[model samples]
Target: MFYRIHQFWQAIHPIITEDELAWVISLLPAPSLALFQGQPLPEQRHALDVAQDLWSSGIRDSHLLIAALLHDCGKTRYPLQLWERVAIVLLQKAPRKIWHTLSRSSLPLAASLQAAEAHPLWGAEMASHLGLDPRIVELIREHHTPHSQEGYLLYQADNRH
Candidate 1:
């Protein structure tokens, strides 16, 4: 609980310095760069941190870096407020049927909840639209599942940051 609280606080005020933006731009293509910049400041910072962590650990796959930077781009469709994020985190532990029910209903946070649930697929679609590597799109889709070795690395790095 405390850890989540701390994470939420950090996310509420993500600080991305100019130097960090320059570093990020140097690593990404124009299309992918646009998507990365489209994300919330906190999410952008988080993605950059994840990519840097993977790089430091000797994972130099360009696709992985792209995946790390744009994995959460789908969240732009239905941006979650701080409370909505907290709700989604708690609701995620509930049964899938319950989650679906709430998400589909006309509840106040329903759209945000549904968006959170579907962001991975949405992100994958966006990646494809941008003509990103198929591997990068797959990573964005499967980051939460982590079945492959690369997926495992990304998942670990995402959790760490």
Candidate 2:
């Protein structure tokens, strides 16, 4: 996967610094485990479904497809189930209400959360450096926060599908 990403990275302009490579890589799904893993990651499946729906809607923008395919890529950086367990363990030492809030937070792993809002910037930089069209980077950056009618529609379809 890194090979593919490296190849793509080489084709684009230099936006992300060398120091940011590991940060960006940490956001991507484990390339090898992504396929034929014990179970398909829900986020990956959701992304694929979103991509298919977008494609079926006659949205020809490759940027949109790529964005939809990777919208939740950061989830891989965090393990929700593990955190849930940790939350449960911590709840034993805290109030029930506080434990409830923590459990319901649905927060990302520390590393993943650290990269949460940063994914867009990272993706934009990655796409720009990889020589992907600017629109593609924009789509990725805005996938979670659609700022227009078109973006809203895309988000709706992605969520609905």
Candidate 3:
């Protein structure tokens, strides 16, 4: 709950230093950087924190860093407003069947929720289309249900944000 509140604060006052932006730029290729830049400021801030968390934890794997930075790129596909994002979090507490059902709903905000729910897959596809490393794509795809140690670590960092 506290984390969600913090996320709300972040959403309102998303701040990233020029140096931090520079750091992210240095880490990504042109295509990947464009994808990162396409995210909302709040999402960009969250991604930076997630990537920084991985770096500070002694994980120097390039793919891990990249995946951490891009995990939410798919969120840009059907972007949500602040209220919608909050509602999505609340909606997530329900069963998977419920979420799946909601995703199928044609009601307003349902598409946004569905997009948020499926960002992992979409981000992975984006990464693959961008010709990024397979490791990075896999990490983004499985951050929600990790299939590798690195992916698990990425998921951990993302959850912290």
Q: TM-score for each prediction?
A: 0.87, 0.47, 0.92
Model 2, span 1-161: residue lDDT tens: 45434333432422434443343344333441232122224444455556667767897665566666665443444444534424433444677566455445666443433444365565556555555556655766676588866567566865464
Most lDDT-accurate candidate = 3
Q: What's the true lDDT of residue 84 in model 2?
A: 46
Model 2 alpha-carbon miss at residue 137, Å = 0.2
Judging by TM-score, tell me the better candidate of 2 and 3: 3
Count of steric clashes across candidates, in order: 0, 4, 0
TM-score of 1: 0.87
Model 1 residue pairs with clashes: none
Say what the RMSD of model 3 is.
Answer: 1.5
Task: RMSD for all candidates, in order, please.
Answer: 2.0, 13.7, 1.5
Give the Cα-based TM-score of candidate 2 against the true structure.
0.47
Query: In candidate 3, which residue ranges exceed 4 Å CA deviation?
Result: none
What is the C-alpha lDDT profile of model 1 across 1-161, one tens digit per residue? 78667678778878888988887888788888989998888889789889989999998888888899888888887788878877887887799898889989998988888788789889999999999889999999988787688888888888777
lDDT of each: 0.86, 0.51, 0.89
Best by TM-score: 3
Comparing candidate 1 with candidate 2, which one achieves the higher lDDT?
Answer: 1
